[model samples]
Target chain A: MFLQKKFKEYYSRAEIGMPRRFTRREYGFMFFERQMMLRHISFSSSQKLRNFLTEKAPAHVFYSSAYYSKPYEKEMKDKEWLGADLIFDLDADHLALPENCTYERMLGIVKNETKKLLDDFLIRDFGFDDLEVVFSGSRGYHIHIYDREVLELGSRERREIVDYVTGNGVSIELMLGKDNYAVPSVSEPGWYGRIGRAIGSYTDRILSMDDEERKKELKNVKGVGDVRAERIYEGLKRLKKEPRAVNALPKEFIEHLKDRVAIESSRGEADEPVTSDIHRLIRLPTSLHGKTGFLVKPLTLEEFDDFDPLQDAVVFGDEKVSVNVLKPFSIRIKDFSCNAEEGIVEMPEYAAVFACARGFCAEE
Target chain B: MQPTILAKYPFLPEAFDLVKDESMDEILHSPAFNRARELGVARVQRALKNEDSFLFIDERNCFDVVLSFFISKAIVSQMNDSFLLRRHAIFEAKNAYHYLEEESRETADAVARSLGIKRDRNGVSFVTFLKYSPNAYGQWKLANSRLSGGMVEVDDHTFLRLVQEAVRERVEGIKFSVDGLEKTLDLGPIRAELANRKVTHRADRVELESFPPCMKSIMAQIENSINVPHQGRFSLVAFLNGIGMKEEDIMKIMAPIPDFDDRMTRYQVEHITGKEYSTPSCDTMRTYSLCFEPDGLCARIKHPMQYYEYRLHVSSKKV
Candidate 1:
């Protein structure tokens, strides 16, 4: 009753912005009559919307990209809609990082890649200075670009932008200067500049890795021996920390170097389907996570690395509640970390909320 | 506002505005712009800065990327700043000139005449003004543009200079940037219209409602277990697979083919499903005569996947 009251009270006062207005709204129930779980969906008013959230307090909330005139109509065509935001979600699973990486490492890789996406492609190249970057509060990040310019872009144009971000179409020919054979200047625009930076980072990562593995990977770069790998590694390391003339590296070396840089350049990965999907529905920010018992709150790019969702995102306070953990397991929720066999446990306010949210435990 | 006529006389305000205009320069210089197959703004810049450097013609797409963006920007305000005439042909030009009374024939003539392009006696050249052409060239050009061009007969920098010189000769670059041609454009509304408009993506499953004519024909053939040619089968499977159809679904689609070689068909379909090979592209489909009948939208799209995406886009916008 207390948890139910907490949810009802929160919704009664929680006035947050919806991503899109006049959406094809649907609320899914947790464990009630499956037949009536998502029926009579509507976009009537905040009161109606809030009522669904509290009365049923559905397990999931979904809103469409469309802004319909009469969203409750039986036929989809009846709803006269306005516009939708261009949202991109980058998840850890989508990225092809080193295989068998841990969840924490996956999140780390995704965060770095997301940062590069915002800084390099979105801001510097595409000229979107300000963007809505949201921590998915899970294993990925969501980038919502709300500029009018983006909305005008068609599917193909959007795909091309995705292509640029993912380094799919970037070519070495574009980077290498014409006629007078020269190593690519870092000052050149577009993919050339991006590749230069990627090289530095890739080299730093390579140097930090085990030398034996590095040598093997380097050998595969051109079938070069360990001597060449050691030489190339050192040269790349020196090149990373400073800039010199364009022809500083050997032509043969730069030729081989370009291929490696291309691979490194492709590290700017994103889920292509998500970015290109025009009518995608995303998790609503500030809504309590159904799985984590934490709020799906928005975070600034500055706070991206430091923000800890497990601890900082907890909404329920220190009030203790009993929950029956079905299976034997343990979990950490803020200061309350509990290990218990398959039975009931008195979890703190946050732990109980999280356990209940995940369906790992139910309130007793 | 049309800069074609003014392109000839260097001193003409329109000519300077057309070629040397900073907006033109920006678009031309943008990484997206492609003049031809390999010669783009970047490659041209590299060539120009280095006097002895020769521009390499790396063949890719055959259309100008910069022009496509220009057309989209131009239609809202100046309608004839640049010509999108097909085949440099005069009949199409005449047709386009006659269709839109508000559009200027003189402006079209001026651009063609100034560029030394010849016209037939009908006062039309194969080249006429188009927002976006209906031909295959125009379709891929628009879809893949904002890239580089193919090999030009003349030197890269010289041709670029001519195009640039036309825009920059007399117009103040900065002034042209501010008040030249785009004075009337409010992209916000354009964006809103686009957002409200339906769009497509890499669909997980095909929507039968949006199937292009060619695919429909192929499906009809397949449904009856008719013998579709190798090209037809390739096109069919690729189109089906591109839209997220499963291997089993594709096999079912292929079941009606004359030979009904399950193993062979499975191999081909799996090739695409596994991403070992991609679906036949727009050009390949056209080459095999497997291209479906024109449905008006065919002019705007190139590949079957593109058609599927466009269908989803259209449906999404349906209200």
Candidate 2:
């Protein structure tokens, strides 16, 4: 109940602007006490949206990436899909991080991944310029692309885009020259060039290591034995200098290296199902996340480079509040870091809201 | 464009416009259109026979070629068989590609643009490539193809191939009214040929090991007495009947369902076979979300029967 009041207060003060074609988008909400979502709703103007926000104070807000001819229709076929903005969601939960990874560290890792997706794939390769990035209010980032060419793509075509970024089905044997001996040229386009460059860097990394480490690394590759590793180590310099020397190593070694290079050169790990789903509803930017009380903030590419969610997304002011800490928890927000144990503690309003909402502490 | 070129490529918009206002009665029964009518029947027969022979184009015969193409379309609409429609579309598109290879780049580009393929300063848009890439091989997939500045960079040959794909889809969707055709030409021989093609028996030896993964999964579900969804049950029954399973055998295979009634199951099985319904294509199965656990072979073929046929051929080659 207190969280709902605080959320309502935030909505009252915040100047939340509307998304593009806001009236055409299907909006969905989950109120503070309700578990089921009230979806397929539309707004006519920013004032109407604001009035609803201030009055209802929904705990979670979402809008569809797709535009429809009839947004109010309950049935999918009746909706008559016009087009959709391509969406790529990169969540830290989907990444293969260490078990004890901290939230801050996880965000940092996902930030780099999102950067690679933006610069390497979307910008450099696909040439998509009309894209926006949002801090997902927790755990990750979302990239929304409003490019005209990608608007009417169906699910299979969208999956092909996913396959390209993820480097699915890239075959090393196909990249070989006529003799099947020479490696792909660095000047080649698409995955060929990317994989070729990755191979060069991986060779350099292997050569920079000490003798024992080098042999261990070579043998660590799946199809390479000790003898094959020794042969590869001897031929490493030749392989780096002359691309055709790739065939000097065991065939299995080159095949395995190609698979590794394909992985290393892939754009980034994007959540596949999200991009393929045309009717996906994403978290509305500038809305406060119910669980963490952090704003789902939008950022420019420059602002996103240095943005810290724990500090920047804290919307509440520094009014002091008393909270009963039911469990030990640590949080750092707005220069106030709490390493509270199970006891009563005085904290600022933002910290109190974050704690109570997270179920670590409660208002006294 | 010259009439001679339009005659060669009757699938083009100019050809359609030229023949659009012509009287169907004259085209079907007029002494002036006797040669056109014969050529049109020959075109449909060639497609039904799965032969991709091209019709010769001459400046003198421009009108006949344009009229014949639409007449062939009318015959296709009169028959109204999905399999024959697909075969005819593919045959015509292949023949178009053969002619397109020798045409000037400007002519080919215009045809492609008319079919909704956009080409700006930056090669063809990725949207065009993706929309037409489904039936293409893996190498032609958007992932494998080269893209720059939001466009797919293609050589002239690849561009026409993309145009060929577009033409196939366009022609496959073309339907003409044959409301008054019964009073005109006798289409009995063509109808008999289609019926004969339909009843050509499969090998008595069924290859259970060669079934597509979707059908295999549905079979497993039914054998375990699990309640398969309506789409799954329909696809499974259609596929089994398509692969030459006996009606009684299909009923036996379906008997393990929890709600199976002997008479009802037999009737439904007979209905599928009696209607001669071909198994739904892979795309349709995917739209219904019934394509489950696709194997490597599934990626190469567009239909369930193709999967079975390819597997059967491979196993026979091994023997």
Could you report the DockQ of all the candidates, in the order they appear? 0.04, 0.26
**Weakest ten-residue segment in model 1 chain A by summed lDDT:** A26-35
Q: How does each model score on TM-score? A: 0.53, 0.84
Candidate 1 lands at a TM-score of 0.53
Q: What is candidate 2's lDDT per residue for A233-321, written digit by digit as tens?
A: 87778888898887777777776776666565565677877997778899999998898899999888889989998888889989899
What is the Cα-based TM-score of model 2? 0.84
What's model 2's overall lDDT?
0.81
Residue B282 lDDT, candidate 2, scale 0-100: 98
State the lDDT of candidate 1 residue by residue for A230-335, as single tens digits. 7777776766655443345445666565555654554466676666554455666766555555666677777776866667677777877777888666676678
Candidate 2 Cα RMSD (Å): 7.2
Residue A307 alpha-carbon offset, candidate 2, angstroms = 2.3
Ten residues in sequence with the least summed lDDT for candidate 2 chain B = B133-142
